[model samples]
Target: MDSKRYIQLLKKFDGLDADTEGENTRSSVSYAILSNSETNQLQKCLGARLFEQGFQPKLIKTEFNNFATDSLDTEGELFQSDLDFVFFVLSPMGLKETIPSELNERSQFASSFLSELEMFVKNFSNKGVKVFLANIPETSERVFGNMSRIYPASFLYQIQAINAGINNLVAKSQGLYLVDLASKANYYGLSEWHDNGLWLQGKYPCHPRFFPTICDEVSAIFSSLVGKIQKCLVLDLDNTLWGGVAGDDGIDGVKIGDGIVGEAHVQFQKYVLDLKNRGVVLTIASKNYEDVAIDIIENHPRMILRKNDFAVIKANWEDKASNIQEIAAELNIGLDSLVFLDDNPFERGIVRDHLPQVCVPELPEDPTEFVDFLTQLNLFETTQFSDEDLSRSEFYYSESERKSLQKNAVDLKNYLSMLNMEACVKPIDEKSLPRSVQLSQRSNQFNLRTQRIDEMTCEKYIKEPDKFCFTVDLTDKYGALGIISCVFMSLKKDHLYIDEFIMSCRVLKRTVESLIFNEILNIAKENKAKFVVGEYIRTKKNKLVENLYQDYGFENTERSDEGSLWRIEVSGFSDLDTSIKVKRS
Candidate 1:
């Protein structure tokens, strides 16, 4: 490792410390690096770097002193005194020999740490603490080209497995994140281990010159773990001071063609467009003639985004809330998922007042700094990007067509019947867990009890005989409305308590809810449950469901300040006429 690179790395961590000091800091994360001899020195170096980065890191010294209490719970008590995240740094010796022998073949004492770790996660997660796990640097064959003492291949493989298993276990147990830092460390080699050096000194990976950059990247990943980044960017057009009326400017004159102002808007639009490509849903909300705006989007030479770029567009003379509602409806997305943007403060204010779920970005005085302003907002940062986000705009366009067709039909049954709607209700599976969790998190209007559970928790329910989760998938002539609803219930003697019930807004008037209710009833009948009980948890966005149970013939049996409980006798409940065809999984 180069000495200058080590100094640079130290400086980068110092910079992070300066940036985070006195910013309503939380309980510091106590990181424990579990490693042996050769890796011990490296862990110490990383620990030193973590201290400079505004984090406290500790290396646990494991010895065969007091086999039970001191090595397990008592020792954990000493180490986990105030720990937030535990980073396990493994080496060839640490994996094949150190851990298995030291921990004694997954003995009862080893099991103790797993339990202790679980408790830590549940306690900390409830309080909003984050955890991260980083593996040691990958030893590159190319970089270690002539080194005689190479790490044994079997040892490397075993260590990787142990690291992966521990990472997954901790993630499941602690709800913390596992970041792959090994490849990154190797890429940067041992250059400026910390930054505070010349820019060109540690920019690339080919030479041993980017260690500071690697440290910077690791610090950034940790920072991201501590915060939830905005997922979408909403855009607007017309003179809050763009040059001309989109309708009147005739595409060429409208400020976004090829000049300074146009260049600025183009740059801003391109910045947002890139965010969308990286899985942020970009939407437009402009009060303009739709045809004129569409023309400009199609014909403008400098415009990077066309009609295809926007996930949804709200271009109408209607109030911003109403327009935003349409946008949400078309996108099959929740209002909370949107970030509204417009030049007019009045429009922004109206949206802020009516639709509090949507994020409204402040307008910058200089149009030139619009892109810079967004960067400052950091409104579109995310760690994971799924494939669905890339084609979200096209999906919304298709959904609009579905909605238009849905409106033409007379009633719920009629609409469902005409479209040939099919509902597939099934026990929750791995493939549908993410969507189920999303329903719990996002479905406020039709949600009952608003219980949010991650995939692991959901998996437990599906396999539990006493509890059941049924998700609904609907497909019409238009397209598939992937896993639109979920119902989690616990079966007791003669009664079933509805723990969770939520449906997507896109399937609102399509008799999907009625079909789901009917399916649950069928299940209850088969199980010999006499009645179904439902709990309603009030939230800001779930007012639409205040009378949901009443509308569905469920009578209030219990009421309290926290939530309302309703009950319905299975025998007495009528099977309502629904046009939706049902299937079981």
Candidate 2:
């Protein structure tokens, strides 16, 4: 968001004085901030952000300047409460120290700083809490001036050493992420970010003036961890993607290249294409004739994206708000998962009115400002990314092909047989850890129990010999959908328990579920187990799978306000028949 909007929102947050009663009691998520500095305003701003996202913000904080005692003591209130995540804010000002004498002394300082960080993070992570940390911001003392690059006793050089070690430590530690506060400080300029007078007087994390920006940054990281990130980009034509109207100026007359004004649009196109490369599905929802807009996409020399690059295209004279709805439905994604970019104020305002869940950034009139404005929102942040993410756009193309074939087929069974599907099931090894954890966070609609596991807990499952953690990748005549489903199970005596089972919505009616169910029965029978158990945890979006166990002939043994439980004897179980071929790894 822009600076002006940040101030406006903070003002709105300041007016919530009467609604501040359950600030300490745990809600949906209990978040604790253990900072070495004063965190009164930081807690307020982060709570405001979470409240805006439809989540109950249970803010937990430590006493001022006593973060160490709260973090290190396991029996303290910080750990005693049901805390889900934590942020460890550190700064050099909090830890008083003397400057090193020479360049060789920098390594010693870095080692000590990293050791302290490791201790704090490991303390929380050992108890199954996710940790978010920030490196100390860099500031120059001006002792060596520009010669700090080679100077023997430069604070900047020492800061660089400490930051380097922070990266290595976070990488080695599972469920730990290093959020760079220095980068944000550099963006807003050091003068606005650092206030020496306020630091000495009240011990604020940064200048109180810049609290809005930093708190927004930290809250966005938590948002992505809960699988609330946008997945698609919906674009508009005319002044939004080019300099002039396509109908009024014609394709040859439209200014997209060979001119000074056209270069700005070209730069914006490159930024959008880069988002596509990183697995953001690109789609167009413009108010134009289909043939004319596609001609430009097909023949324009400066266009960075082509017609095939998009997963769906809705170019017609219909209202942009309805077009956005159609795009979401066609892709089988949530309306909140789309980021719509339109240059016209009228179109943006209309969509915002109709779909409050959709993210509509206020694009400046100047095309040059488009990239920077969108980059600052951080709309597509993610907790985990994998090689499957890089090729996810192809899955949409495969979906399109399947839709066309289904339209011509005689019936659902014929469509399934025509595709000739195949499913490859494998145990979750170290190589599949990243994608498996990502699916755990992303899938909801088809999840059996919707258990979100982190990499560290999953690694423990891999090493425990008795637990079964596996993944399934599907392919057909059309194309491949990599790692689309997963099953995590364990055994207790004679019964095998299915803790979590999740599948992508794209494979909803493809009989992939039947193949997986057959595989689970096989695993239980091979282990000489007497019964197979399954669970159904009720959530807002998981109603699709509430009757899944019943359809498979598992008897419902238990039901409650929480969820339902089912069990089937192995002697009575029969293999579920499916058209898809199966292979094991």
Candidate 3:
């Protein structure tokens, strides 16, 4: 493939490219390579590709060292610099002799190396750097083995074991990615690269042709890691969800009974279940009755998903785009997280135009292709799966229930009182710091300002006398809602500047805002400040918070080309009576 074709393929693969634009702008990402060679042809190819696309490519030379010397410290020095990715080249290294035994019996050197690598990744991830592990060329295997025929039997096994170790390390490291170079090359086979075989090809060990291909693969993997994956998969009911439409042919007539189509849906549901297992939230935005959809999913012999499978279901009579946004609000997730799936082109087009970030998968004519299509479109891939993934669907499902409770109430004030809620506020310590920063970066609606703060920045803010950051954990008689909200404020002059005020949409209309206002006013009063000020910065998905200041009686005192600002007098601002008991940490 040409450079353009390579880029297109990378986009198709949803790989990383820092200068991603046009149709593949969503896939833009940055990457760096870790290598033992500084001037290899593969590195040149990588640099060229990145340069053409206006992306800065990083390359690290992996020089061998005698552990008896200060190689570890030197490696540490190299790692302290800015790096997002590393490809440990195993070729030049004499792996056959080196792999089976540790440099020391305790394996201290290797452990230290891996541990340092892990620390680097964690620190970088906290700074928003994504790292990937790349497999060294397989051609190096024979070369290394030829040089160590005495250990011929253990040669391949040794390299495999080292690769496995790297894989394990990558899996354990947060924000670390892996590129299966060996597997990909093996799939296409040696014949594809060489006239005789991969070994005979002119490109064999540092092969010029293989370098470009491998570089492309590495670049593609990096692209995929840089951006946020789509969160929710909004599925249709008919052939998309199940096998047939229940409205046309009745519940029994639906193809999701005990047939081939039925099996396809069964597998499809299992796939969706796997996504949920990994925290990719599922929601149904179908044009069918809620009861009917639930019945099919619950009672059907072929069904694998149940009523609780969906985080938010919009089975009511509504436009797909409208329903999708509603789902986003209910789950407290962004519209960008939504990936709308429909069998009909019209519905897909509607969502595509109305909700552009809501990824609308191309409608395939056949149902069997559904799995393959989605597999290729790995919109749900994450760098790591957290404990939260297992219960995310239930969390959003409970969020929907909370919304239902709010809807029946007379007003926001009454709704908050009726819930008999309590807030558990806490300073973000070591245990809660990651989750707090993650929420700060990810939370969309109800967010006053969308500042993507890092963990270090959060720590610094928490220590500042002028600033305050607190997370609110809310729970009522309904269920335990974990870390439902957060607020960041600072004292400035005669006012308490509300820098960040965001609550989980699950806690919406529950007087969380009023409670926050009261807390801020109390802080202002205690600090001897005369006024409380706040800003409403606009993001496409956070329009819900634009009028938030008005709800809390904060009048617009300043308006500029940048954004709107509001302030409430500490003396005059009345603390809205809230039933939710507040506890400060």
Q: Each candidate's lDDT (Cα)?
A: 0.61, 0.81, 0.64
Candidate 2 lDDT:
0.81
What lDDT score is found at residue 551 in candidate 1? 86
Instruction: Show model 3 residue runs off by greater than 4 Å.
Output: 1-229, 289-294, 316-322, 329-333, 363-369, 383-389, 459-467, 489-499, 520-538, 547-559, 564-574
Better of 1 and 2 by lDDT: 2
State the lDDT of candidate 3 residue by residue for 96-157, as single tens digits: 33443532342233444455545544554654556556654343235345553334333444
Quantify how close model 1 is to the true structure by its C-alpha RMSD in Å. Answer: 10.0
Q: Give the winner by lDDT.
A: 2
Runs of candidate 2 exceeding 4 Å displacement: 1-27, 95-107, 150-152, 560-562
Among these predictions, the greatest TM-score belongs to 2
Question: Weakest 10 consecutive residues, lDDT, candidate 3?
Answer: 62-71
- Writing each residue's lDDT as its tens digit, candidate 1 over 1-585 gives 455765655455445445555344332445443323222233344544555544544434333212223224533553455544444333322222433433234333224434444454444444333445455443322322443123223333333444555566654553455555565544444232322233134221222243333344444455434332344556777853245678776776788747777778877777777776776767777888788778777777767888777766667788778888877766656676677767788888999999976878888756787876766445553433334445445555566676677678676556667788888889888677766765565455777776655455677788989898898887777666567789998999889888888886667767776777788887888888999998898865677778788888899988876679899999997787677888876
Q: In model 2, how large is the Cα lDDT of residue 276? A: 84
- What CA root-mean-square deviation does each model show from the true structure? 10.0, 2.7, 6.7
What's model 1's overall lDDT? 0.61
